[model samples]
Target chain A: MNYPNGKKTNNKPVTNRKPKQTPNFSNRGMTLEEDINQSNQAYLSSGRAVIHKKPTPVQIVNVDYPKRSAAVIKEAYFKQASTTDYNGIYRGKYIDFEAKETRNKTSFPLANIHEHQVEHMKKVCEQDGVCFAILRFSKLEETYFFPAKKLFQHWDRQNNGGRKSIPYQTIQQEGHFIPLQYHIRIDYLSIIDEMYF
Target chain B: MNYPNGKKTNNKPVTNRKPKQTPNFSNRGMTLEEDINQSNQAYLSSGRAVIHKKPTPVQIVNVDYPKRSAAVIKEAYFKQASTTDYNGIYRGKYIDFEAKETRNKTSFPLANIHEHQVEHMKKVCEQDGVCFAILRFSKLEETYFFPAKKLFQHWDRQNNGGRKSIPYQTIQQEGHFIPLQYHIRIDYLSIIDEMYF
Candidate 1:
């Protein structure tokens, strides 16, 4: 099949390309987490922002210390995080958010977020920090920046028999679509600059 | 030996004390990390501040999944963190800090801090985020909240053949001494309120 850009899509691998002309592997099949991490690194290097993905929480059950080697974790379990995935300072403002990708094309599932995370976001908002979620429609290759306030409004309505998931149409209308740039792959902060700043 | 309050200090276990009269295990022999965690928890519950210790980073090497049981992390190693231990929003400000304890009575050794952490703190400071270090003199039973700006000044001087460690006198004079409270424990935020607000 030919792409709109006139490039053929085929299973056969191209082997004639020179090493200098090789495509950037970092961007290929890159997960949202990897893209954000690289973008955060770019921001850090350029002094644009200081943000980091919090380490995955783990409960270590056992460890083994050899006589002359690094300590090895023998057994462990993943622990549910009490806060969002990403947080830091941006333009003198406290920035906090969680990022999730959904395969569904119609709506973003509420189950993807935890109750504690919602509570944490509410606390951050109460403290006047800029809090939000980066929801990626993986199948569509589109991403949206949804503010915490809007998320809370929907979450609160869940008890009142509101829709359990955020419809794609609502997200398309209400959410800020993040433009994928070459350097700043996920330029969500630009949206933040426009919305909050 | 007798304490100043006339309480006897004995190695002998007190068998006469009732279970209800026993001290809270959470507070006894608690490390600085535990104290801050408890304090953060108190602050969180009281609607005062929202802070959390970032999870200890771990690099998972292998995992085993049984048919019906939970997946088990069979092999892993602790990964060095790229950021500070604790960070969150507090009263419309980004709060970022690292907590350290030293047995040394006269100085806080700069070697305890990594070069990357210093850089991270510098970035946070540049963004106007409130950043600092919580230094605990365990032997002296004292903790001090040292501002990041002050830390940077000392850090920069080391390159010019200045002192490699912060003198006890300097910390005592420049850093805010956080008094250990009965319920609140490490009341460092009180000092923050006094300084920042």
Candidate 2:
């Protein structure tokens, strides 16, 4: 259809023009990241668990201090992280792990993980810390909790001519898969209880 | 003695050019922060321990990922952290704690710590993790590891009309005071082996 100004318009009514992306503030809806972050915060606030995501590594070269309370990080470069994504105390044990999301339907590719992260996980396990990776397939809307040991086995086999990814069937068979609930977004510890404890 | 500007009558001046202000960098080749960073890295690299100073918490407001590997953190703000400075793995146990430096000779004022950090330490201890604080006296160039159990007692007693800060005498008597050595740099794990393990 043409408007008076001769601009063509789709006759269909425009109820939803698309949502503007919001920042960390929860004003907008929450994503999986936000849900886990809130759950972690709830854990901390209630003295249940003390877990936190290490901030994304950034090599801050220049900082502008317009005000003492607020320093603007300027001219910063991203740095490769040397450790896992999340770590903290849970039920008298140290918990450390990485979280990844894949859209693939068949399997989780090993390329999603980095060499340093694997090494970090190995060290954490050796140090008697509970280490693992949380894999979420958004397409499947399913999450799986695979202990670092399993991931290590798969990682090592990749070097020995095995597939460079963990097949979904193998993961379902060997991994302690976690179910997502509304309140507990990731709800990983539940699986840990059944698997480890 | 008078020295002419153009004519250096005397090769040696009575008052040598005010000895170049010992550069902040020269007086100490590396800042205390740098030294601690290097020590922590060595700990992580050698698999002796895994300790890291949490990067300053940044609230990422915007990002420009012009390339796949280059997700530049464009605008961010530094947020005050609620927990301690450093934490990691040591001796098959989860180690979590903070580091503080003070120039005060009489006492390391409790004001150096926040209420939230003390609470975090307590939670870490309850989880059966190793939690402590590394105190450094910049004036004396000394470092000490004060266990969380002892720290919690002092922290709690403050609510019952006790001293706010643990005095240096008490720290020396109760805490495992780590002696500064040339090669060891902030050798804390040795004390851990002797005291805890």
Candidate 3:
């Protein structure tokens, strides 16, 4: 088919481009973000864990009070996150981490992180808090739980003239890869129990 | 003055109008929010505190990718926070609180708080973490650290046919009033140490 812009169009090709329906293969279905969010809900509902996604930052500009009991915000801006994405207390020690998923097949780039976040994690580490990063390789369908120390090692590697990213083999060698499951999804704290507790 | 449209041009006086400069008052010269934020920075810089303000929530709709490295949000909505403005770990306990400033000369209004936040605080309390409200009566130039238990008492009073609002006298009577300071601004941990530690 051809459009007014004179470019050929075909829905069949675009539809065929879609990956397998299985979440394990496709980046869309049961994404890590959605699964982790569900896991958090399950944790809270079952009293198994108390964790939550912090609210996104909004710079509220105006509010319209159409009714006495309700105020509607008119404008706002998204503020950059100053700390890690997730945090909570588990088995007494404070838990903090940033979860990242990459489509790259070769190496996980360090550019995904912010300097202030690195410094924040370092501070959390100093306070004896459990801190780390959870990396998911969507292309490989693999998830790895890496300690803050290891992340820092890779984080500092960029400054010391090391590679700007960690290779897949390096993560597979040093990191504890988590097994995906039907229930208790992510199941990262199970690894936390073995490694930390 | 009457406008050409015959609208009275009335400037309706607003109620419970808090002062424009709520972050600074002469009695302490610094509001508790400023103090805690500064203290959080000090803690972060000196490797002593890891607490931080979570990202402000923004309901993002459109994004403009001026460059691949930067994504600028174009449209969004502001979400009311489910929890307090800040939370983190100090000495192995989760620190959580909602900081507010009131100008009332006699009592603080309950309207400053939301129902969901109270529920969230209850959960924080159940987890044995420190939860409280740092209320600053800017006009009175006073800051008080009221425990979650105490706040819950008054919060529940609303359902028990008790006063919905807490009186200034009652706060001074039951809450641990924080001493104003020059350097260790809003030294509330001192109160925490006496009550909790």
* By DockQ: ranked, best first: 1, 2, 3
Compared with the true structure, model 1 gives a TM-score of 0.86
Which residue runs of candidate 3 sit more than 4 Å off their true CA positions?
Answer: A1-28, A58-79, B1-32, B66-72
TM-score, each model?
Answer: 0.86, 0.79, 0.78
lDDT of 1: 0.82
Candidate 3, residue A14: lDDT: 13
Indicate whether candidate 1 or candidate 2 has the larger lDDT. Answer: 1
Better of 1 and 3 by lDDT: 1
Residue A33 in candidate 3, Cα distance off native in Å: 1.9
> After superposition, which runs of candidate 2 have C-alpha atoms over 4 Å from their true positions?
A1-31, A67-69, B1-32, B66-69, B156-164
Pairs of residues at least 3 apart in sequence or in different chains that clash in candidate 3: A56-B56, A56-B57, A57-B55, A57-B56, A57-B57, A58-B56, A58-B57, B43-B49
Ranking by TM-score: 1, 2, 3
Using DockQ as the yardstick, the better of models 1 and 2 is 1
List, residue by residue over B1-197, the lDDT tens digit for candidate 2.
Answer: 23223332322221222222212213144345665676777777788887778777777787778866767777887876777777788876777878887888878888888888987788788778788888766665556678888888888888688887788877776676554333345567776776676
| Model 1 chain A poorest ten-residue lDDT run | A13-22
Model 3 agreement with the true structure over A57-149: per-residue lDDT tens digits: 566666566765545555554566778888876655678888888889888899888887898788788878888888888877777787888
Model 2 agreement with the true structure over A1-197: per-residue lDDT tens digits: 33344554332211111212112222224455665687788777777788888877788777788855677876677788888878888887788889887889999999999999998899888888889988766666656678899999999999799998999888777676554433445566665665557
Candidate 2 clashes between residue pairs 3 or more apart in a chain or in different chains: A92-B127, A127-B92
